[model samples]
Target: MNRSRKIVLFIAISIDGYIARPDGDISWLDDVQGEGDNGYSEFIQSVDTVVMGKKTYDDVLKLTNNQYPYEGKTSYIFTRKETSTNLNLVFTNENPAAFAEKLKSEEGSDIWLVGGADLLDSFMKEKLVDEYIITTAPIILGDGIPLFKANNPEIKLNQKSTRQYGEFVQYHYVHA
Candidate 1:
């Protein structure tokens, strides 16, 4: 019997647990001194689908100056506003967790849950997230958009592994 594809939350967070600034600025991430691509290139290759909130979609576009990363992969953007699909991106107003459940059942590689806070919370609430690959940078934002907002279900994680890339620490965990 085959299991559903995994929904992995692979992200970097500040020491204070913020993923980005209030204005969606993630420039601080560029300062981290890490060896190689900090496992990003390898991680990206392991998944063929990306699930992200609208804000994260916008931020990636803005941050890349409209270059649009995640080139060879399919991306689903959860939003209330109307948006157009281009290339590998599909904009949808579908319920995140509901849609994700269907996607997980489909034949594919693992799915990457690229988050902003709200989307992560929804997946957390529904217990859809199967694994988490969090890379904690050495710097603290003090205040910003947190990685996990309040009211997320308390999940017990099995510590899979931990690796250090310079001052950055990468943690691998799976739901227990």
Candidate 2:
């Protein structure tokens, strides 16, 4: 297993526990504005490395038109297929936990897994994640990707804090 000590999975979901729409689109989130001191932007700024799944990466690329926001940060893309890009992107040659541990060994900054269902499922199954910061929007999408798929193990989280910003409610959870 990769020996990363500091790892976090951060995301925003609908009240119904959907991270993205059935079509893998987050356009609904655009209108919400998800404002206030969710501390996510600040938290992401503190991290040095970000890990993501291939599908998640593709969706982000499509959404952003390939213009990634996190510049100068080391990002590890986990995929079985070989990918090529003109921009500076690191391909993780190791598994999620192992890759995270390697980053820690290199004195890497905090690691955040910004992802799709599969990668999150992998990390959760491995029990390598330390914290979860989830923002729940006021609206609900009945059908979409569940926060954790049925294949995922049961996780017990100790709620660290909850903040309300208008219609948005942010929750901080850590393994119990």
lDDT of 2: 0.79
Q: Per-residue lDDT tens digits of candidate 1, residues 1-176?
A: 78679999999999999998888889999988998989898999999999899988888888899988998899999898986798899998887678887898899899999997998998898888999999999997899999998988789999999999887899999988
Q: Go through the candidates in order and give the clash count of each.
A: 0, 4
- Per-residue error (Å), model 1, residue 115: 0.9
User: How much does candidate 1 score in TM-score?
Assistant: 0.95
In model 2, pairs of residues that clash are 2-97, 2-98, 3-101, 4-101
Cα deviation at 109, candidate 2, in Å, is 2.0
TM-score, per-candidate, Cα-based? 0.95, 0.87
RMSD of each: 1.4, 3.2
lDDT of 2 at 165: 62
Candidates' C-alpha lDDT: 0.90, 0.79
Candidate 2 lDDT by residue in tens digits, 124-160: 8887788998888877888988878776678799999
**Regions of model 2 farther than 4 Å from truth:** 1-5, 36-38, 83-88
